[model samples]
Target: MTEINENALAKMREVVPESQIHYLTKAVSRDDKNKLGCEQKNGRNVSADGIFCGGYHPKSFHVAYWGHADLTARLLEADPEWNWEPLSVDDRGLPAFDQNGGLWMRLTVGGVTRLGYGDSQGKTGPNAIKEAIGDGLRNAAMRFGAGLELWSKSDLRSTQETDDAREWLVEAQAAADVPAIREIWQQARAAGADVDTLDKITILAQERMEGGA
Candidate 1:
């Protein structure tokens, strides 16, 4: 087996920052008659005031993701010469799709190449092609540990917990008085918030005070 460099792998696996993260809502029917039925909507499309208007549907849930641009940025940051190519092309020189309408591709970064496959998820036309390419990139990037957190069950649970704590912290920061903020901080600390959460609480409190809020 070929050995991967520890430092290189570490750099590739670095946790993606929250600012670059995006969320999409996905829903699946729970009824036995339609268990396989599903739908997906982009984050913007499902926002509180977006087309869906009332926010996510009862059966839908959000999933964290990095957009194609964000993934490309990460690849470039990890390996400036990173590149990818379709596994096959048609007579017209366009990328060819498989029997299932999925595309197969290879992604190479830092001299390591890996195969990945993607599909349009029932979509058709130019947008479907773009979506396939983006999905393929993300699938291949996973082999190199890029954006792995979004794919990890344990990490997802931890992230959810952190999100809950952050929500409380944010509410505290938005309180009308310093004392109210301090009280929330006490509750958060007593709940065994992590170091990062504690630090955030302190920083938010400082910002609130500095702004006379």
Candidate 2:
């Protein structure tokens, strides 16, 4: 694990300049191995959650990759110029050396970066896999949007919660019940719906009733 993290970091340092480089390491915790720290509203792992990065703003862009040690070796072999410091393990036995910990690397890039995590064992070097993950994330980000806005946990969670709203809307639409819509609008109002989002929902409801999509 140490080898992989080191290799991945090294590759990143090599790919980017030292002036642009930033290294994040955990501060160590009692339950790092057993459970994840509390998830932040921004989707970052807080110290309480067992995630430690050197320094990062909640809105900062990050590129993460997870893979086996062999991938690290391949990355270093492919790019000997890269360099990195080895992070030490904590008491829970979570370090680069422990297989259970897996290899983790995060980098900040000007543009969107790619990311991927493999579930099965593969022949590719961990470094290559990480590189590919970075590439994939970058590509996806480019097609839609960029920046750390996509990294917001609260917003993403809110959107996920909308899935329930959407389902309810579908059911209501099928029934074409104005009373049902009124009930929902009242509920939304009581809940203190954000003016902007509520306005959009209102438009949707209006369109649906008007036989327009």
Candidate 3:
């Protein structure tokens, strides 16, 4: 196997820029017959226009996602020759689906390759294939840390917790020096700061040190 270049790997793992982030709305039926959950009036049903999935009805929630085009662009930006292919092809030389009706594929970037699987979620025909390809690409890209943060539960902190983390982040960023920033980071960690918060603290410390703050 070819070794992955450290610089290229780092670039591939860099947090995706906010501008490339997008939101998707998913709906869950409140009816008891729905497989997602039992019927309950936990809160009011709401609706919103989804970026790729179209409008959603009440009982729907929004989630952050990176679209297929964005993921592809990022891959190309990280590795000019990045590529992907299905694990197996059918008699007609087309991508083959597994018994579960899902597609398995491999994504290669910076000399690293990983496996990912995707399903159409009941969709069929050409659209199903497209959706599976897109989903599989996202899954494989995640192994390389592309858009990984959005998938992390650490990014799902409650509003109050997020507010507190941001407040700590402001303090860390405003520290007089690297030592002060380190001290703040320690405090935040002891206070049970999430992964995202700790990452920001570490990044700020590195910036300060690099600039001789």
Candidate 4:
């Protein structure tokens, strides 16, 4: 990755700040929030069967691409000379199909300004104009090379729990009975087995029925 410019870095902090993750306290009830620290909710905070650990926290979004407006204002402030232009638009207008457009930014560096481009597409309805605009802008900002580093942080998804969920799935599927499998399916979902894994079990059933095996 091209190193982010020091000036750009400074501007990024002012623009896209890190997400504030407030650590949980007893007042923050377990069912009330999406996230709670591992310390307090240690015993059965997620699954009753112990397959899900709500505290496992996989990838965290420190500075998620804020919607269209904030990003534009932020980038502009960072570089007063910076400019954005719409590069392309979908030929079939909105309501006919989703809006897809390309946007480019002109950012001035030390003494020079360079162009960066981004592409964005969004579903046909709602605040799509705004949505498409933001998508394109964030993509361009990525090339501007400042706040994009927020994505560099990685999280170690809890492997043991994931494996345990898989094991329960295999054993449940072994029963080859609809009711038994259904029970496991619900349990797995509550336990936080990912959708992909859960979908595989459904796929397995479909394959067996189609093959008549």
> Which candidate ranks first by lDDT, i.e. highest?
3
**Pairs with steric clashes in candidate 1:** none
Please list the residue runs of candidate 3 whose C-alpha ends up more than 4 Å from where it truly belongs after superposition: 1-3, 27-59, 154-213
**Residue 134, model 1: Cα distance from true site in angstroms:** 0.3
lDDT, candidate 3, 135-181, per-residue tens:
99988888988789988842553565669888999999889999999
TM-score of each: 0.55, 0.26, 0.58, 0.48
Candidate 2 global lDDT: 0.39
Candidate 2 ranges with C-alpha deviation above 4 Å: 1-159, 189-201, 204-213
Task: Tell me the tens digit of each residue's lDDT in model 4 across 3-104.
Answer: 335675467455355442122222112222444334334544433332222344321212223455566666666766555544433465321222334445
Local error of candidate 1 at 187, Å?
32
Error of 3 at 181 (Å): 52
Q: In model 4, which regions exceed 4 Å deviation?
A: 1-10, 13-15, 19-64, 67-69, 88-122, 153-191, 210-213
- Cα error, candidate 2, residue 55 (Å): 23
- Residues 1-213 of candidate 2 have per-residue lDDT tens digits of 123334333343333222332333332222224333334543433332223344442212222332224334434454444332214446775423225323332322322223322222332566654544444333333222232232354356457546745654555455455556666665644443333434555666777678743
- What range of 10 consecutive residues in model 4 has the weakest lDDT sum? 21-30
Q: Best by TM-score, which number?
A: 3
How does each model score on lDDT?
A: 0.71, 0.39, 0.74, 0.49
Cα lDDT for residue 78, model 1? Answer: 78
